[model samples]
Target: MSNNGSYSNDRPPSAGETELATDPASGVLFLSDYKKHEDLQQMLDSNKDSLKLEAMKRIIGMIAKGKNASDLFPPVVKNVVSKNIEVKKLVYVYLVRYAEEQQDLALLSISTFQRALKASEFFIPVLLVDPNQLIRASALRVLSSIRVPMIVPIVMLAIKDSASDMSPYVRKTAAHAIPKLYSLDPEQKDELIVVIEKLLSDKTTLVVGSAVMAFEEVCPERIDLIHKNYRKLCNLLVDVDEWGQVIIISMLTRYARTQFADPNADDDGEDSTNKPFYEDEDDIDGEHDPSKEEKIKKTYSLDPDHRLLLRNTKPLLQSRNASVVMSVAQLYHHLAPRSEVHVVAKALIRLLRSHREVQSVVLNCIASVSTKRKGMFEPFLKSFFVRTSDPTHIKLLKLEILTNLATETSISVILREFQTYISSNDKEFVAAAIQAIGRCASSIKEVTDTCLSGLVSLLSNRDHDVVAESVVVIKKLLQTQPSEHREIIIHMAKLVDFINVPQARASILWLLGEYSDRVPKIAPDVLRKMAKSFINEEDIVKLQILNLAVKLYLTNPKQTNLLCQYVFNLAKYDHNYDIRDRARFLKQFIFSENSKLSKHAKKIFLATKPAPVLESRFKGKKRWVPYHTILTPGRLAIMTCLLSLKFLLILL
Candidate 1:
């Protein structure tokens, strides 16, 4: 390594590095001699099973690692795509993983990637469309991983073409492809509705599961279109398949809960009497308090008349399916905040207290619902207070949920509860309390102040989720209270955390962006630390940072000169237009700040007045003349007669 410690910039050999004539070994022109790829190709082609499989496996790993083996992919994909069935499967797996995990491959031009995707079509049909049921099933699984929209039309066509295919698996895979297609275009949702409506009636369980999952994902957006066919969807929710049941019930209960919460009713309670379903009454617990006006304000903002929704929520709480029950409990926990909220709150407490598999879902649901409802949250808080010493995942889950759900109004109570829990000296219990306090750091001024020590304690959590969640909370607090959160934000900046989970680096970068102000104070080393991560981040995160830079520039232009420079450079050279567009738009803010451009921009802005372009174009243009003009014979005859009569009268 050089003193500068910079990586080498040597260009790898092109795919055509080896010419056919020059290489005596395989006589293949495009093969590189140094890699001996030609020899492996020959061995695989010679029908030596052991050697072939070994070579395939090694190549698979190479492809996965994206070996400086660029010259190898095109030939490898071409040769293996149509080879033995096993070879095809292995190759497809490598390519799919390449698309999914390897960010470097995103640098490949769109056209090249499209060609590789098109190559997969040959296998897609064999895996999804061939006579062998297993091969076809395997193909469907692979296609789901492709994540390309262009394949949607082909998959949709296959579903239509193979309606009578013998394999139920094939038919089922075809049905599943429809929503995956529709997810790319919401306009295609109606078309998916048609496809799913047909598949819901299929006798096969696989088909039923596929159809129900599609409806669940798509229906939230297309519910109005499916209103007429709602019964069919509702009936399918009872199918014997567990997954089908989970999805359908989740969709139904969620929609029903929302509708019940916001049922349109006449003032003076006239509509309630007519509609038995829309009952407006107090909650069963009757612990409702009017003292917490902020709670009521946030609750009513989400749903104006909780009375009707809470009335209809009874059956959902009683749902036989665990998922349905959980979804309902969650929706109510978040949306239902009247004194009657104890109904769902008690239900969640019972579910949590029971140590069921659905306990976490229930706890998270309680957290979601109780966020703004102070008095309503009090019962849950009291339940947790008593259950604090209980050594169960349920207890831990409850603590974690309550921590996240704390708002400005509830933070004081939560902090008091945490202080009480500290006496127990149970590390995990204290950890849970600390983590929750971290989530609410920015929620209240006092919470922000109190969370500092807890957040410091949590920085060493071995669990990445805990650490990352703590960082997120710290970031939120810093963004919320930049001045007072200086120390805490500074503490968070020194952390060099690497989360191996995919798509998470973006969020972590977002946290950095949120705390960028404290970069100079808490961590003067933030930019240098995150430089590599920013380059390796996904487009979404890049856009987020660009946006954050714009926002920072908007608030404090002088401090953000370096940030603006980075944004402009990225906008000019970034691989994607989305990044470019964001950078370009953000540049306007910086440009507007400049005194010279400000004058020019104002002049251009004022001078570029709206013009009547079409009207001006028509100014000197001739009007259209019909090719064969009609004389209006009858009208002309009447005019002549009138003229003759007038002349006779004048002569007389």
Candidate 2:
């Protein structure tokens, strides 16, 4: 390769690779790269150290230029025995570059790296306080990893002194070394805890995280040591690196939960769940300003340090690091007031734009938090809509989040997004969309007509899974409002003969049998169709067939007696034990005048069930506007936010 990135070939040209030269036969203008490679190879085999070092430097330069030089590995490995330390370092640097792709070559060089370490006790202490931070850190790590039992005393002494080293880099290294020493000599764990506590109070954010880690491993029971450092750790949380912030924030969250009273607990005759986080209710939505009496509510109170922690911690939600954002969000959930937990919602939503792995974890947090404090996420509903390119897991979580965010005002827009999802090529996504629609209908009464219409349209879908899952969600909705969706029951019963999915078949039978009073003529017809194929049907469908048969027998004993009897007889001799037992119980209940429980079988199958409240934590409670979040910049505290986000409706 020439310097200007244009190739000059003195030898045969590579395939599709052109050479730039004024003369090709005489080779007047071009430099020969082939001869340059051979010259460098000859220098690597020389007896003098300087020639080998110079040759290795050229190889390092070639590797840095993105050139393949695996042919030089054997020469580099031979140079590790050089008396010059710089030559060994350059050779190792070259070897490390190709370690992953050249695993066999790296294995051949393992003993070479091991031979470079000086692990003797006589020379160990001298390197522990070396002026170079990398050497000081590496020396301790290598010494700790040495397996000789006699070297334990040297490793312990080296760790104790280095734990208080002037360089924070060395102290952080010592923190990692403490755990290894403790593992080798468990007797020194308590003494190591004392050393770790000093490292924790080092007045540097650099060492505090690792010190706490060492403390966690050395003596986790010694949390009493953390009390003095609690305020200091909170102060240094932002200054710490991303990983350090994750560790410290997790430790602080655990500490705050146990020491402080619940942030949601009623304080001085006030229920925080019903109150919003802001001082004025009119600030969040500009549409209707509340009256003065309702606008000014008492602030949800907190302990001083808790207030300081939250005050200092809110800006980290915009961190470039995903784990840092996640850690801060969790801290708010665990320690902040109930009304303020929604502060993490927008931050978590922003993570959807990240890579799929981070998006997955962020979605899980959204799913858990939205189940309890859904109103907190209401403003950002469109952020949860499924993207066309999302993976299956992300799509599933977004579906759950969108379903949980459904409300009377927002259900219309949510149903519109669900309509698009129902048409996707992925069957699982289609089914989840169908389920999301059913959930919206079950939760919001106004949208039940819309969700039912969408689901009924899906019953005509060409994909079998879409129609099957649609039936399952529709069954749940119909069971909840058995009388309101009478028309849906007739439509579902029409597809029963053509449907082959067991869950869908069982769901169809359940809707027909449970609401048999609404579709009386279709009930016996479904039962007659089911009785002919009862032997081939799944156990689930078979059980539902018995329930449908018995429910129909109670409604009209004269017209459906023989049809019900045949289903019962086929079920009685079925392969499954549960099916047989259920069949015998239903047949005895309906056909016998001998049992006392048979008289009121009508009341058993046709009992009226109350509508299910969507399982959520703050469903009935008032929506909360999280702390430090205000639309109008209502106070000086809003200025503390690092970045203010204006969430817009994401247009499809």
Worst 10 residues of 2 by lDDT: 643-652
What C-alpha lDDT does candidate 1 achieve relative to the native structure? 0.53
Please report the TM-score between candidate 1 and the true structure. 0.40
Q: Compared with the true structure, what per-residue lDDT tens digits does model 2 show for residues 317-429?
A: 98999999999998998788777787888888788889999999888878877877779889988788788888998999888888887878888888888888877888888
Candidate 1, residues 198-307, lDDT tens digits: the string is: 66566665676666676666665655544443444444444435556556555655655545544322234333222323244433334545565356454343332334
User: In model 2, which residue pairs have backbone atoms overlapping below 3 Å?
Assistant: none
- How high is the CA lDDT of each candidate model? 0.53, 0.74
Q: Candidate 2: lDDT of 108?
A: 50
lDDT of 2: 0.74
Residue 231, candidate 2: alpha-carbon lDDT: 72
